[model samples]
Target: MSGTDEASAREALRSGDLTIIGRIRSASNATFLCEATCSDEVVHCVYKPVAGEQPLWDFPDGTLAGRELGAYLVSTALGWNIVPYTIIRDGPAGPGMLQRWVDQPGDSDEVEPEGPDLVDICPPESVPPGYLSVLRAYDHVGNDVILVHADDRRLYRMAVFDVIVNNADRKGGHILTGVDNRVYGVDHGVSLHVQDKLRTVLWGWAGKPIDDETLESVAVLGEQLAGPLADQLREHITADEIEALRWRVGALLREPVMPGPDRHRPIPWPAF
Candidate 1:
């Protein structure tokens, strides 16, 4: 039921016999929970078919799957492992994205009780210690609550990765704590736009200096864009979008600081 080798996992995802298990109804785009069996090893994954993509006014039709893969490529270039292993291939519905499912425990079959969330809404007066507050707001009933994310470094790394990709929908629900104890970000179908459309709930580290290590990673990613990474990204995004990524990276290295929320649409609707 498992394949740990990187090459093996990639091959399995690329050619494994896939069986749709169920639909994750919460997703706006059609999303299928599937079991991919390859070489007799089974791996659970999420599949989104291009045939089911909803038309967007801004983004071109049927390109979301490629955008998801583009985000994965940026994550890989940074050596951050921020995104799950992802690929685009033909499926029962048609060609689309195939991403390895992240187990809640990270790699276990035994289901563990859901643990503390990486992001949460808490009483304004009692934001959890070691958590940084993002926004203060009223919930459905009108009581005051604050949007907060963990003060953990992994989340910060994700936040930086978000900046690099210009992630436009980084809802709190998209952040996951996996079994290997790593924080991951998912659902990046609406990223890599040429225009600025950054929206997220991960503003806890806003206005802080990025760590030297991460800045170094950003520098490396900026350089990769002019070469192989840009070539691969062209399969999903436009030349202008790739160039915008280059611009964002250069700007970050010049500033080396976590950005404050933009004046327009700083956070996504329904923060959680």
Candidate 2:
């Protein structure tokens, strides 16, 4: 999504209106980058509803709410600013996921666009120093911590939802860099895989070393998993899921790196 188009789409979204201005081919859906109009804000959202020939990897039992809710949960756990969203309406194509658009900072006297590409927030140079660092840390910790901290407890719960639904793409591009310099991830219709398809770039720092702060955070999260966090997951996810979530977290803490999709190849490389 380009900056100009993002602006226009945001305007339409604020009005609760939608105009399918363009199309994109994602691994899972034929995405339409549209302008959405909600009651108070205009957003440029990429609508991914059910339509067209089913992909080879589609999860038959997947629901839009399930996917959005999972992402929302994880974002909340990471202390990232992701808005609550829904796939409210169906388009000509089919059902679509409606999400809040992450606004880019304008090149003003006070707010300089520090990131490399406003479209896709990227490496250190493009981003305002501390911004990307925080995001990377969140990704690193979230991927490794699992059930340790309260925040990460929610994150693990969400990850379980992703596993149950078979989410195949948790790539960096799916994450959004909000105007406030916080990170928010979007897109999760491809989760809950019965197979091990956790492909992402958020774990690049794994196995190299674990910091005290990070290790301590993970330990806290692990303890939570058997306590209040465990109860929280029981409400939404199955008991098996809670156990699986704990197991995955335990595995990471034990070794930290065991090689997944992102470890070997680019899992949505060149994320902006």
Candidate 3:
């Protein structure tokens, strides 16, 4: 079957029959790589069941799947399209969130031998002049490696989205470089907390000014939070959490600059 559009993808996730093709063991939660068949087309989706989530001290139990969907809604409202199309539905395991899988290009990780556009992986010295350092790491062999991302506009947009959502866990692996050359973010179950726990690797733009277009997008999102989006969020999260989201939006709009990392728990452990 051919690939489906966003609307069709959402429909498939909602009504399709999910067949577990494999298990993604790397995730802390019980995540499944599934094939969802709606009508004539088969779409690939990642399913995270509420039943499989580990209890956390801060976030309420049985609400992570909804938060995953909430992140997608916020991304769509801002017109950033950072998160893939996602929906809450009943799957093989139980009720959960199913998101369309992004197919990333191989070139995202490949390194060229000799070219101006060579992709560098690890080692602080290998990073190109314009690239921004994201985090530092040590390999298993005790060698120093520096993680960095290209200085791109899409990265900036994603940073803004994470700030608005109060994302608590934004790791390097969560940022997918799709085959279409667009960046998509995944695994947002830990976001939208009522507390100020915005840990991420996209701090390269910290204290930087946000452009007009991005500011306009934030403004539009702020308006939506006061309207129907607020109503929709109430079905998934507590009223307090929704209000906290509003507070974050206002703070970002007022400053329009990237805030520095928290003194305590600034970055996610195992950043990649």
- The list of candidate 3 runs beyond 4 A from truth reads 1-6, 107-121
Clashes of each: 2, 37, 0
TM-score pick, better of 2 and 3: 3
* Residue 73's lDDT in candidate 3: 92
Per-residue lDDT of 258 in model 3: 88
TM-score head-to-head 1 vs 3, winner: 1
C-alpha lDDT of residue 241 in model 3: 90
When summed lDDT is taken over every stretch of 10 residues in candidate 2, the lowest stretch is 144-153
Query: How big is the positional error of residue 223 in model 2, measured in Å on the Cα after superposition?
Result: 8.1
Candidate 3 residue lDDT tens string, 192-227: 998888988888888889888898999999999999
Residues 1-272 of candidate 2: C-alpha lDDT, one tens digit per residue? 57776565545543466767787765345667777655554566666665542445344543443445444443344332343343335664655565555565652367766524322333334444222121332244344211111123223333333333335565545645556655455676554333456655343232344444444545555676777766754544456645765665565577654333333332444342
> Which residue pairs clash within candidate 3?
none
The top-ranked prediction according to TM-score is 1
RMSD values, in order shown = 2.1, 10.3, 3.1
Q: Rank by TM-score, highest first.
A: 1, 3, 2
Runs in model 1 lying further than 4 Å from the true structure: 1-6, 106-115
